[model samples]
Target: MSSIHPLSMASPYIRIAHDFHTEENMRIGPTRIVDHALHYFKEGDGVYTVGNRPTTIKAGSLFLIRPGVPFSFSASPGTRFHMYNLHFDLIEQEDSAAITFPYPKQGEPQRVPLPCCLPDEQEMPVSGLPSSVPLVETATYEQLFFRILQRFGQPNTIALLQSKSAMLELLALLLRQTENQHASSTSDGTYETHLSHAVAFIQSRLHEPISLDDIAKAAQMSKSYLLKCFRNIYRLSPIKFVMKQRIERAKCELLYTSKPIKTIAGETGFDSIHSFYHTFQREVGTSPGAYRALAHSTALQQEEPE
Candidate 1:
């Protein structure tokens, strides 16, 4: 699957979060689905046929099926299958509740399909999502799936918001897995090792001046390869990550300690307090003293009995 738009770009609307079960040896559908769906098989084994292509599926198999896809499921003999099925629209629609399942079921008169019901190649943020994600050993994915189901049927607004949030996170996790899998294939096992070593070196000496040469030395790779790896894996340049870490450390010190801002700046490797103040303002949108004061005020409010 090609890379697609980020999940954060879309406002997803979940229509159904179902816990589905199949009887032993049961066969369901050869029917087309009307909306985008994610099915996570939690138990048993089965054969899922899509557009006449049959694939064996067992517990922990996760599949993404787009609208108008003809699919069917056949359970293996003597075993019942359980699946968590989530149906949603990448973009929210006003009439989402009125959309029917199976679009035009077989033998029914073929009517014009709703434009909103059919998946749009451009508008659907996850059009490039792979048909399946390997979740067999990932408990985090399983928990996120179950979290969607747990909040889906609740009547409270908090639960509804939580279900949407969980779905977004699940989509992000799937995309990350695909990207990591691609990176692993191309990097030959050096991606994680080099990244870890580089990050460790940076973190261990955050109070000292760090340069690209030092990072590359720590990673034992060329500067160009180090840049490419950092961009692909961390989505940030090494220098930017260093600045981020330093700022983060400064923020923690400002919040948790009464140390003077200049002292914190010196300890975090800034060339001077002037440079630290400028960089902190640029990165955090506030002066260090203001941030500390605001944090303290917020903390005092939180500590006050509500």
Candidate 2:
């Protein structure tokens, strides 16, 4: 993990929020998630599942699941952890109707919502973990996440954008690392021009509304295939990637300009300010004004000690 590197140090989407782990406490606890769940886990071993089937989570791990997929597991005894529970409200949008707010010539296949999809019986099995944790050394994967979360104490466009970009990069790095771990072998390949083009297209239009289809088309791939590949590479859905970019750019106006929040929302490809506010709050953990004030005060304090 230490040798892992990224081509883009400046990704516009998918970023960290906050990351912290217990330094002293070495014990673990059990948790029950509601219908839908999104969370992060680090520095422990655990098994999670929708019900019966389980997947092992190790150090430097993050998990996000919808209603049907339930994660249930416990970490190794004496293992430390830094974790988060993330719940996304707009994840249920139907796939058939593409979100038409931004990004040109984009379309998505209809998605069927399985409200009652649960794990069937007969998949449960308890496994005794190793007496000690594995030699699972990891890099500073959570540093950007910690920074993003810490930014909630200060409000401003620069910090917000920085956090958003860092989050995107961190998520991509995570997917790459996880995939690499699961591979039986490795393939050495160069980058694709089309993938680069698609990324360029997204970055070029960061301030504009862009759709998943638009990105896929730019990459010369179908919606489903592009989404699969993109997630493999970026650890985020296309729409989500676009939204992260928009929100990142919006932070620019939020910090430097005096424009109304509604205007900022509109300019950033949001349907309305209320929608923007909700999304912003979800990502940053604070209201826009509150963030701005926090950032301003922090800047003042840094410049002139109180």
Candidate 3:
């Protein structure tokens, strides 16, 4: 009937680290959000508050505010400027800096600054970005922040994929933020590097018969560990991700080509036409022939509709 937030996903919407949001403020003073927020002001002046405490935001100011912490903002009377606001999640406060907030729990927003690792209810001004980030490019994060805010969420059939894509983009933005802000601490570095190897390893041989052992070897990880990593970081096992990718490719081929199902199966890497059919039905909830027909009908309906 309607759409739901993707964050409530059973295994965490993002497979890897906790997700976050980024926004470039055109003007946020007139409204409020009921989620945790990390505001990095790039330009102009605005007044913001958490509960009853007031915080002044301007270019080069950053603060982490948690959900239910009442906050409001107002642009300086004559300022023609905007600020980038980012809301992010992490594994732990120890994994980040003393200023980072790991609240929000995936779907809530704390718009007021909360003390990192502190049990206090009062607000405070903190300095420094997360360990994974650097300084000086904080402004660049403003642009990325806007992009994150733009894609937050709503409802759709593709809600899962859409939220995932948004998270991936947000990850890139955060990494860039770390770089730009010159974070005092360095990121693990290999989290993405090894992850890239894993994906490329899978992609390079998708058409052949392969096993978890082979894939893990290519990615330099143990099979068991890789499965956990894949599930945690991608919200899927390696095999599942491969299947999903193959199915997406198969959908394109089915709609755009006149090839036979057996041939398509071979091209997409199934051991037999039987396996292809089963996987397609399970993931897509429709057989290949049925899907093709439906896709064709939908296309024709669109072409002829008022």
Tens-digit lDDT track of model 1 for 175-281:
76555545544346677677767877886777899999999999998999999888886578999978887887787678767999999998889999999999999
Listed per model in order, the count of residue pairs whose N, CA or C atoms clash below 3 Å is 0, 18, 27
1 against 3, candidate with superior TM-score: 1
lDDT rank, highest first? 1, 3, 2
What's the lDDT for candidate 1?
A: 0.73
RMSD of 3: 15.4
Candidate 2 global lDDT: 0.51
lDDT of 3 by residue, 1-306 (tens): 844322223121321221222233434432343333555655666666655656665555555454344456656665644445454432222323333443434565553443222112122112222311222224234433432443344234344344445444544544444332232222975555565577766655667876788778887877887887777655688888787767866776786679998898988889999999999999989999998898667545444424
Q: How far out, in Å, is residue 144 in model 3?
A: 22
- Each candidate's lDDT (Cα)? 0.73, 0.51, 0.53
- Stretches > 4 Å off in candidate 3: 1-186
List clashing residue pairs in candidate 1.
none
TM-score of candidate 1 versus the correct structure, residues matched by position: 0.54
Model 3 poorest ten-residue lDDT run:
117-126
Of the candidates numbered 1 and 3, which has the greater lDDT value?
1
